[model samples]
Target: MKTDNSNIDDLREVLHWIRNLVTGRLKIHFSQIDDYLVENIAFSEETTGLASFAITHQPTFIEFAVLALSYVPHIQPDFFNKIIAEYLPDGGDFPEFGCVKGTNHRGILPTGETAQFIIAGDDIGKRIAVQRLFSSEHWFAKEHVLWLEQVREGEPAMSGRMIMNPEIVELLTLGTVSKPSFSIDFPAEHIETEMDWDDLVLPETTFRQIQEIEQWIACNETLINDWGMKKRIKPGYRALFYGPPGTGKTLTAMLLGKQTGNEVFRIDLSRVISKYIGETEKNLARLFDKAENKNWILFFDEADALFGKRTDIRDAHDKYANQEVAYLLQRVENYNGLVILASNQRSNIDNAFSRRFQNIIPFPMPRPEERLSIWKKTIPQQLPLDMDLDIENIALRYELSGAAILNIIQYCSIQLLADTAPFLTAEMLDAAVRREYIKEGRIT
Candidate 1:
């Protein structure tokens, strides 16, 4: 096992910086956690902290020998003596690894350079602890550290790599030591954080499905990493939320993005479908490319527009429409992020694309119990209520979509604002409901 001197130096520096950050003696600015750290950390206009990166390295025979010699001397004498005398009488506790030869399988170092460090652990906890020790202050003595020490920008502080042995690849991690770097240019285009989930009330089953998506993100990080490494194959999660319009289909799509740290980009098929040959496919290509690069959730609200039935070649138009669906099939298969398609008419979507879905959740209309819950939740706390106003009766009679219910409530409140009584009467509530129904063309 042979350790690179520069890497060793980097490890030392990183340990020192970590101690500074934890102790408050040094200011540390982390771009990833800027929202929380901006208030405490300090940096000049020219200096910004390093971007942390991790890698795992397997020790060579020479590298392992050096680490044992270097770190062993620093361990507490009691711990060192107990193992060295008793364990090493024949060699050491299970014979400290890093003592294999590249060609000759004997000794602590394959090449026996005696400078490499061998970090071993029986479990993930110990491995992670070892990584964090170097990542923080335990490895660096306080006296050797200075105040206001900063991590250098663009310099990778951490590395996570797999240590390849015959049967397993043990994960190893390390860091570098460098002063912070400054950004040469500010981003010209910035994302607006104002995007929020819609105000549609959801059923318990629907809410649980959304939560499952979040859990999947946490549990499937490794799968995502693997997908990222694979080229050409667009890796995206497919979800089908089928329900009637105004039943919270699009709202759920936005909620998925808002909750999962992804941008939700709704695909407008009106803009995507074209009369020109190959134009529809070209539009889809562009849409997928941008969404993939930005890690956005490409949402197809009213999926029937693009994913509707594929017509036979009745004419050139019909042929192009079929081609458009074919193009979508290819692009979606390769997309490596979340692609959500919401349709009021799920039956309209072609079977060719339906098979690609991993999760197809039916977004049914709110049941009576669910609607009762929505009505209770949507009422404003501040709105004055007349004891005579029967909200339960209104909810039962209208059986409206959550959006419509909310709108009706708002309309009722406004209409009653000038009245002496703050509570809405049944007559007023009925009027509000009638107005909403007429607006939706449910009545002429």
Candidate 2:
């Protein structure tokens, strides 16, 4: 059966058939298999063809079977178990994959050995599947595949645990492949927010930078294909969004993700730092490994965790911390996708990290015009505004960040709703602003 471009079921059918084909090897001939399966392999029931994404670009059923077998335990581990099942009484044949001599366990890469096996029938039907697969472009490089395969074998390298990219994991298990992007793992217990571009309220310079970011994202694929570039050209697509808290650095990141059709993963350094040495690097490695090959944007909030001035070697901790920073530099430089670092203060970022970034757009607090926009957009409608509520006057009265303006608007909406007020008066808004000031610790 040929499958559609992404014929998941057809893909499964090919693998299952291959599974049975390999299993039949236990017996001297394919005829020994169940009649139902035997007949299916015999020209099958009007084979349906599918277009597969195999490296060879061949969509034949045999090509799909080859791909299914090559990925090994990385995909359909259960199926591999069945294909390699030991129906034979045992003559030193591994029960896991029933190959007597040459068999690939499908780790990061093949063991650089041919996985030769007999394909049923007579002695002349010997074949080497690994030899063919090694000649193709695996989903991951052999080294990376080997690393993962080793890690799975319970002998993870000192580099700590790395994992298959999420997209790969989903493809193997769920039969679905997603566009490349980053999303937070709920188990990680990190709070991040995403918003549309329209939702962001920022000063003109900041908005211009966001537009530039959008343009950069649009040109990303062209930069690779047209520029003869595997990595980015000089002035890489990295950015530093520095601003006071609530000036929309985080919001801009979400907007960028939405605009670019990529998943943006926000990492909070405050939550990521660990007291244990090497744990931080392990976590960061895991993050990078997961993001690799996936079209994703890494948004690091409170990046001073990695960018802090290297302290004089006061102790071993200091030395390791510097190593962590160095590791970050290398990863970011090599990362083929986008990386955005946000900080409350530009001065807080280390010169070393900041120097490498291509864009360093500072977010300034909203001015009166932007504040007016924020008030108009955030304030809910149908709340009776006391004819006395003057939006222009409120915007003029307080020099507020977009965040602070939203907070006051929220308070005003709640107060009006709670009191069943017919109109939201200037007095109520003024009171809300007062509460915001107090909340900011401006007064007791």
Candidate 3:
């Protein structure tokens, strides 16, 4: 199951042919070390057989390579020697100079960095190494080790190998691959924990949809599994959450992650959305690929920005906007992992693309009774409580959302604490109400 250079001669030959052909025209001189990479039969031929193994066992090949290469220095085996001889056959050892850039050895272009050498192992390694080559001002030995650590921790190879420049290492790494993404279908596994969904102060409708989302995910396991397999992915999910803000959309997302026992990655759209045409899609592709590999649930907090309706093609700008939507449509529909998009106005989303979402949960505003319940829950049992506090009357008077109720409760608690009194009072409640109304823009 574990393959070193010993069993990869076929891979070595493959790499040798690939490099010789590529180097002749491109003028990018690859040392035998680079040649050894192309020849690496272990991952090349075994990549198909190990497809399941690599994805399941080594979630991130770059990370795997990092760990693999870090140990290479310490590995007293012929594996590394054979690989090294393919490049530096002239009896010169790669200078283990404490630094990566200032080295006497030219194992890779412009510098003798370990990241470059690491790429010979897998596509994941190629991507990570490419990233380190261009991104850093001066490649340090520590950066190489960091890449190794990321791989060992099971992080995605894309993040590891994609150099900052997107030029030298772009071919095998970040640039969009020509391969059409595979669509695997797996049965949805809907496993429920003993989560007291009632504890969260979200709307009943929203809560029900959250339950439905869980069920949808569970029921569609077949589709998910198939999607992952066809796509050569380990596991992935994608869903959209659109409703009015302050209705606990974000909180509900966190709870969903808690229920699923997966770490939620709330995407910063500003960071992911690029101004350059087609770049946004590329970035998204990279992110989803990485997330798929790492098994992280991606949460787009402001879903509208990225998933907005396509505008009329008034100008070149309009065309790109539509293109963005089209690109997102393809990505979201195919994503095999938990992908959540929260929007304040559902109408703002394109209907054509929106229909693809398996779970669409609406977060309606709370009714007066629900608001009353929220107030009671907001006032913690440990807090000084006035038993005579007419919560029903107060709830009717304020007509506050769950968020507003919490704000009021917090204000009352603060006021109660400031005073020597141990109990929340009517006056404190009144002040809190006024403050909440103002903060929530209810008066305006």
Using lDDT as the measure, the top candidate is 2
Candidate 1 displacement at residue 201 in angstroms: 4.3
How do the residues 1-444 of candidate 1 rate in per-residue lDDT, one tens digit apiece?
112444344444433432233222111111223221212212121111111212122333222222323332222223233333342456433322222222332222211111112232234564454444333363221211111123357632322111112111110112222211212111011122343544456666777787777776555556556657445333667888888777777777766667777766666677777778987787776566444544667777788988888987988888778878888888887776777888886798888888888777777777776677677877778667778877767667676787777787787667667674567667667777899989988987
Query: Between prediction 1 and prediction 3, which has the larger TM-score?
Result: 3
For model 1, the superposed segments whose C-alpha errors exceed 4 Å read 1-201, 224-234, 418-422
Instruction: Show how many residue pairs clash in every candidate, following the order shown.
Output: 44, 14, 50
Candidate 3, superposed: residue stretches over 4 Å from native = 1-196, 202-205, 222-238, 420-422
Question: Cα-based RMSD of the predictions, in order?
Answer: 19.0, 6.9, 12.6
lDDT of each: 0.53, 0.61, 0.55
**In model 3, what is the error at residue 117, expressed in angstroms?**
14
- Among the numbered candidates, top TM-score falls to 2
Name the lDDT value of residue 27 in candidate 2. 52
Candidate 2, residue 409: lDDT: 76
TM-score of each: 0.54, 0.74, 0.59
TM-score between candidate 3 and the true structure: 0.59
Better of 1 and 3 by lDDT: 3
